[model samples]
Target: MTRSTLPIWRRIEFTVLLAALTVGGGIWGFVELLEVARDKTAHSFDTRILLAFRTPGDPSDPIGPGWVEEAMRDLTALGSTAILLFIVVTVLLYLLLDGKRRAALFILLAVAGGQVLSSFLKLGVERPRPDLVSHMAEVYTLSFPSGHAMLSAVTYLTLGSLMAHILQRRTLKIYVLSVAVIATLLVGISRVYLGVHWPTDVLAGWCAGTAWAMLCWLIAHGLQSSRARPLD
Candidate 1:
């Protein structure tokens, strides 16, 4: 009846309920952002937020020390396709070498699926990058949902959760997940600061990314539980 005495299935049920809520909320938020993206008047928030990062009368010069720009660029690279792919490759190789084929495969499918979904949504929305200000970062993709933000969430959060599942200590689990969340946040914020994406784009990316990552986690959890048949 108490927390310590609760069955494993019961704990899993709780997690399922939470993940369901997260997915539903994320979908709802993305829909709302999509509607806002279509409304011209509603884009004021994006303009104001983007311009705030620039100098008072100059869109070309961002308002900050030189190092700040460098830092933002570094943060942006953390979500770059090249960097994310490298991380994915390294993790997959490690898992495969350690004989965690199932986990490795799940990572591959989750990240690849996220890339596909990001592309589909970008084409579906066909939103343009913010032109109200000069872009500090070069981007060639459609911009409703920031791909960097989304993919970063998909990669870091999925890997973080997986690491948490592997580690034994509760503190370590929390630390790993916290770092993942922070990295995701920094990537999203960097997109906005660099004038490459509207704030709504980043928001939608975070929502969708979080939802996808959590759903994948739930699926992996179910698979793990099913495979670990315990004796009565």
Candidate 2:
């Protein structure tokens, strides 16, 4: 047989190594962001970035064209509780029907755990929403780590990584992962644009969400690797 020439990073062992690095880096970044958030003077940069999206005199008015405002609301919904529940339920049903019960359970636990973690983190930080700008959307929860940003990253990345695991081709795997990353990023940006979350809040969300998703992936990978039977 011809020798395989795939790069070292693409191999299973190296991929797991990279995933561990991602988890560690994400956790470190989140801790740093959390410290900055607690310091009033350190948050000036975050305030400046948040203000950039709004008009100088009127914090209520975002700078983009009218359509952009509407689009942002729609984008923000991607991370809403109702929409995320629907997505998880639908994916779980499909996975179950396809006889991939392990994957289905993985999805449920990862997303639900993320939801619980997000709630607790918000409560722990007890950070109030930015009063400097008028919120374009309604929000009732404490702000620090944004729920939208975190949930979107956790949900999309978990689903994407799971799908990539079973896919046969490298290109298709990359495509699935790219879409997941893009969706996560867009949701985070939409939160800032809509004045519902501080820039640092979204940053912390991304870091924590990414780390959680990768941890779940690492667990699933270990289990699957140990089994001789295919996941499906």
Candidate 3:
């Protein structure tokens, strides 16, 4: 059936299923990419780019802190913290406003599920963070897909979509979604700029997270519609 003709519940279910498959396929593709990245030639290319951005520059020197590098490092840290706080507060606000236990549970699951997926991807890739410069912030995990980039995408975009659903003003809904997209983009850029994650890592994070967020939103919307429907 055409989309307009489909029942709301069916449409939601289809969207959610599509999202899940998208994310699952992306994750599988990412894993294959990681395998390719493990090759010596690929590793060299990745390392070369990361080393190029290192701080404290001397053309001959491998390591030194430049002003630009320092600034980028600080920016990344700031962006990371800000996004974290925003997600926490937004989830709490949703819980308070919705007063539906299921809504809160879905939000929690989406965020937590994203985090877990990030962790697993990091381990699977086992790529080390850049060591060319003194790191501005301490980090100990393998850094294939940046956690900050992924989580920011999941939390911010998911909330934005939900807000768009509930809010009456279309402009306001667009504004909310714009902010979410902007935040997610900046966070991913910050990871690359700080020399902590490879550009590809950030890109993969953005892709994976976006897919996951869409999936969660579709599921949540379906649940909400089911609840709203009158008994047959």
RMSD of each: 3.6, 3.5, 5.1
Over 192-216, each residue of candidate 2 has an lDDT whose tens digit, in order, gives: 9998889999999999999988988
Model 3, 54-160: lDDT tens digits are 43353223244576556656556533646566766676676667675555666666777877877777777676776554455567677777777777787787777
User: Candidate 2 — which residues are off by over 4 angstroms?
Assistant: 1-12, 40-42, 228-230
Measured on C-alpha atoms, candidate 1 has an lDDT of 0.85
Off by over 4 Å in 1: 1-13, 228-232
Candidate with the greatest lDDT versus the true structure: 2
C-alpha lDDT (0 to 100) for residue 125 of candidate 3:
67
Best by TM-score: 2
For model 1, how does the per-residue alpha-carbon lDDT over 1-232 read when each residue is reduced to its tens digit?
Answer: 8966888767657767888789889889989999988775548788888889999899888889999998999999999999999999998998888877777887889889988898788887877888877888889888888899888988898788776766679999999999999999999999988889999999999889888888887777777678552110
Runs in model 3 deviating more than 4 A are: 1-32, 41-71, 78-86, 97-100, 131-136, 227-232
What lDDT is reached at residue 171 by model 1? 100
In the predicted model 1, the residue pairs found to clash are none
Worst 10 residues of 2 by lDDT: 1-10
| Error in Å for residue 70 of model 1 | 1.2
